[model samples]
Target chain A: MLMIKTVLHFDSVSFRYPKQEKGPLIYDSMKFTVREGEFVSILGPSGAGKSTLFRLITGLEQPTGGKILLNGEYFSNRLGHVGYMPQQDLLMPWRTIWENAALPLQIKGSKQADMRISVEELLKEFGLGGHEDRYPAELSGGMRQRVSFLRTILTGSQVLLLDEPFSALDAITRLSMQEWLLKQWEKRKKTILFITHDVNEALFLSERIFVLTDPPVSRMEDIPVPLDRPRTLKALDIPEIMVLKDRLIDQLRTKATT
Target chain B: MKKWREHTYSFILLVVVLVLWEAIAFNIKMTFILPSPTDILMKLWELKKVLLLEHLPATLCIILIGLGISIILGVGLAISMNSSKIIEKAFYPLIIFSQMIPTIALAPIFILWFGYSIWSKVLVTVLITFFPITINTYDGLRAGSNDLKELLLTMGAKKKDVFLLVNVPSAMPHFFSGLKVAVTLSVIGAAIGEWLGAQAGLGYFSRRMMTQFDGAGVFAPIIVLSAMGIMLFLLVKWVENKTLMWRKSE
Candidate 1:
């Protein structure tokens, strides 16, 4: 079997806020790796420093100690190697869906004509056809999220980091979005590190899940879901899924209490 | 339909006010103190040649030039201030202090310096109009959500790209809002400057009329000035609406 390269690696990372010199560390000697073309989800409780990890990866914040390697290259406090979708949609209210999605390409100094063509094609594939002229306010929440997601993918990065992308969606919409995302991931074959607090979501989407304990994230449990490809809602009914879900939940509950 | 109703109501109120004015003027029998609407209209028609030919052009020229200068300078200053924390810290207090010195009080000084020329009036208009635009644009530029800025930075966007794409567009609504106030004030500023000292303008003409106790003449230019103010305000509003079509007007 061909070896899948690691797209993102955190080698014994440590971080703490500057203002809180005496406070408890947010991360202490954290370590993880995401393979190329794999869907990996980071599952943790609230206030578990998941966002801080994302900031560090995106180069928005610098790690106090340790190294972050992207595509086998170490980058400290630098951005633009990975695609990032923030927790909020963050679509400019003044811009249309097409313009908003085209922003990444525009920033890269792509020709307007080329940007429009690519963005339009992607919008159609995202099931947002014929909504090119509509502003952010006119779109539904789910549609907005899809537009945001489309924008992230258009950035042309090999790895994508989504920070709780569907957290604000209704349960039904969130489920549908997850399925849609999985379909997109399979087609694109890009390395994706998804962050979510929900155990079921993590199980349903990722091949391997990183269950992080609350802050100072000193240790993590990596659970592998040996499920078949092209998963559905019916995957939740499988006996193995149930067993893993209970085990993961018990682990999280115990960690939370302790 | 709603707009039509509003127009009809305004017309009715205007007619009621005019009728009351005519009744009061007739009862007092003092055209010098309070001219009847007919007297004012007659005077407007009589002086229409001089008013439209001589004074209106001068006033319009001064107001437009003043407004143009204010917009360019205000927007420039706002962008500069927004780009640097040091500039913002240094200039913000001075800008506020400038506003405290009433433009009306300084109008005479401008007139003295510029010697009753159109420049004095333009300066007054600039002084009156620029502050709001600068302040509003500055606030708008700074008001961009941090998440959006961070997202842009992560997308490999340079600082210039962020300013042009995010800050400039975001500042537009506030710019238009400031323009509305500035446009209305431009008329008053021009009038004040002309009133202080001017060879020819509606303001100068009105002052002459006031001194001569020609109530109808005074009232004619006053009506024209108010109309000019309203028309300029509406023009700014129309442009704002066209430019910011994404904004739903409440």
Candidate 2:
């Protein structure tokens, strides 16, 4: 039997605000893992610690207890080890699309010539071929998100954390973006941990859905979707999938009380 | 059309006011007391060569040099404050306190220290004008939340990288706003400094005319100085528009 490689692991991690402001612990001895090239969606309701988990992963907030391992090795500093795509399409207003895409490379001090060539290729691949000269305001919502994603990818990390990346888009645009993201995940083979509140979005995108039920979330109910590869919206219409979706939704709704 | 109409109204108001002043001056019949609009205008025309070529240039020289120094110092101070919380905590209150003491009160001290030279006038300009630049740019630097900086930091960005990418660009709009205020104040600062003590400059020339009871002559330099201030302000505005062109395009 071939053993899957765990690309990221939260080893008994715990976090509470240093101020201890009003609430119980946000997370108590939480643990999770992402396998190489696997896409995982963390499903939860609003005001849950989903984005906070990403922040800990990104080293914006440090864990009070336990180690965050990347590729089975712990680094004291976890920053720049993963690509983080925030919910907002935070394309710099001052930069053209090309310059925005080139930002990560520029920040990392890559050679200007190499940065230009690489940025050009990524721009073309991302379907931003001729629109490089335009500013963020000129682009549609979907296009701006794509540029944002392209910049995240340029961070040159094997792991990517997407925080509600498609929540702001319209329904049609969100579906298309989901499909595009899935395709990109497969092509890039990067380990992805996506955060979303939408149950359908979680089901459509992930091989596994980790349900973050409530605060002081020591454990998440990790449910494997058991779907075949290269999924479609049509795949979700099956009766068994419907049953699972309803069960998950019911679990989500009542979990707050429990 | 509405804006054009408003400007025309202002022009008509000025004409009415000047006519009233002319009528009043004729009634008073005191050339030394309140010169008529026509008399002031005539004196302005006659003194055009001296005012424009000599006094105007001297005043312009002081304003330009003083404003230039203020720009450099203001940017440096703003950046220094932005880079560290400790510096901000220490200097921010001091900067505010410095503004409390009047620039007129400070001008005499500058003259006492630097002794009626260009340096004294420039120092006074800097004192009056640098505060706006420092405070506004500092506020602009602090405008964005830590999210953007953290975003860059997660990309393996060093301190310099973060400053270049986020801090600098974010502060630019605020910097320009401060600059517009500073440019207008710079004219007042320079003139005041020259007023307290100077052989040349519009302020000195105007004061000299007043002592001689040449009311029209005093008013002539006043007009020249107003023109200078308006011109400087417009120039600064044009530069601001050019530099922040991205803001408008968006």
Candidate 3:
């Protein structure tokens, strides 16, 4: 029996925004793959096209050249294959917390009776069970971010594209959210390509980290993290991981200098 | 603390105005030309049933009908402009020109076309009310956040879904703000239309009372018109609050 791998394969993807004469292209021959249930973080500087990577992978922009495939199927042909969570909570202020959580299902034209139980389970899983009736404004930033995550998960897409999902939260909240997200990712086991600027966060959550420079953006280094599951702050204190971090940091610094 | 102070200060200012009006009236007996707070209150109490219960409903019907038409046309035009740059380019000039054409001047045209009927009043209300709604909705729709839109596009939301869900809801605050202006405009528009030509309304009643030189009578209906305007304004505000409570919580 051949074991099938649900993977996102990017080959030579290139793109630029409208009306730009010459600048670092957001993507230039970018290529990578996220296997089933793998968490891959793309770490780069502010203008490094990390955000654009999410855009390209999620079909927001058509790459000037390249092919993108998810589970051996072309991205162009698929419908509703990937779920995207933006930096902002993006919860509709008019909707109740429950309604906001249920928005993906609502948009997909799912039936109320069916979505209720699934949404209930998801809210409980994300520790937002009782917040069903409350509006998005009533929730704290951390809580709203958690709800946004749940909304992404509820979409039932195999591939999840998250753009700076925890960038808005405070340090303490972001720490906790990273742990929570890791645990959820473990259970749900979807292929995730998360974009973030934080080196520590990329190291903490990603199975593999792709460090990127500012556009003319190519992968600086694709470092595999050998840390154990449910990685703790203590694990990050390991000598080899520290050395790898220093190396990654130095590469980013050299890119910045050039 | 800052929010609380704002609320408290506004409340105090309202009480001060009412107190001053009542106090000066007591000091020097004033006529109905500038009715005192007390006199207005007394008149309101006596005629509440007749004004609020009867004539107020008539005025309200014109306002609601006019306001509804404005929203539909404004939102419809906004959607059209959003979809086609050419349509926006074509109508942008016309919308500005229409705004320049004074609503007061157009009231008589409405009367001439629709006659001295409720239709004329409604037409006038629509003319006054439509512009704000259109401008606000257009700006709101056009000024939608790129990040949110990109996110939706990636999520495989179709164009219609983006418009109905993201664009429309995002523009809602702007739309309601426009509605707030239109709410006041509708009342004024209806009255102004009636001012030009009408069978029965507060405007017609005010004219009749003015002809008789019954200052109190004229004052009475004017007060009622103001009260009606306030009611409609508050009603729109209440709806705004209910719909946009999330903004406050945010």
Q: Which stretches of candidate 2 lie over 4 Å from their true place?
A: A1-3, A21-23, A256-258, B1-6
Q: Write the per-residue lDDT of candidate 3 for residues B1-250, one digit (tens) a residue.
A: 8888879978999899989977877777654455577676676677668766667777778888999999999999998999999999999889989988877976777777877778989988888899999999999897777776666666667888878878888888999899999888787887777778776777777777677755556668788888778887898899988888777766
How accurate locally is residue A135 in candidate 1, as Cα lDDT from 0 to 100?
A: 93
Q: What ranges in model 1 sit over 4 Å off?
A: A254-258, B7-10
Q: In angstroms, how far off is A201's CA in candidate 3? A: 2.5
Worst 10 residues of 3 chain B by lDDT: B29-38
Candidate 2 interface RMSD (Å): 1.1
Tens-digit lDDT track of model 1 for A1-258: 998898988899888987788888888988888889999899887778888888899888888889999988897646777899998999999888899999999998999899899899989999999999889999988999999999999889999999999999999999899999999999999999999989889988999999888788766778888888888878887898899889889977887787
Q: Show model 3 residue runs off by greater than 4 Å.
A: A1-6, A21-26, A77-79, A217-220, B1-58
Error of 3 at B41 (Å): 7.6
Candidate 1 RMSD computed on C-alpha atoms after optimal superposition onto the true structure: 1.7
lDDT per residue as tens, model 2, A90-189: 8888888998988888877788788878888888998999988788898999999999999999988999999999999999999999999999989998
The better-scoring model by DockQ among 2 and 3 is 2
Best by DockQ: 2
Residue B92 lDDT (model 2): 90
What TM-score does each of the candidates earn? 0.96, 0.94, 0.87
Scored by TM-score, the top model is 1
Residue B56 accuracy (lDDT) in model 3: 72
- CA shift at A151, candidate 3, in angstroms? 1.6
RMSD after CA superposition, every candidate: 1.7, 2.2, 3.7
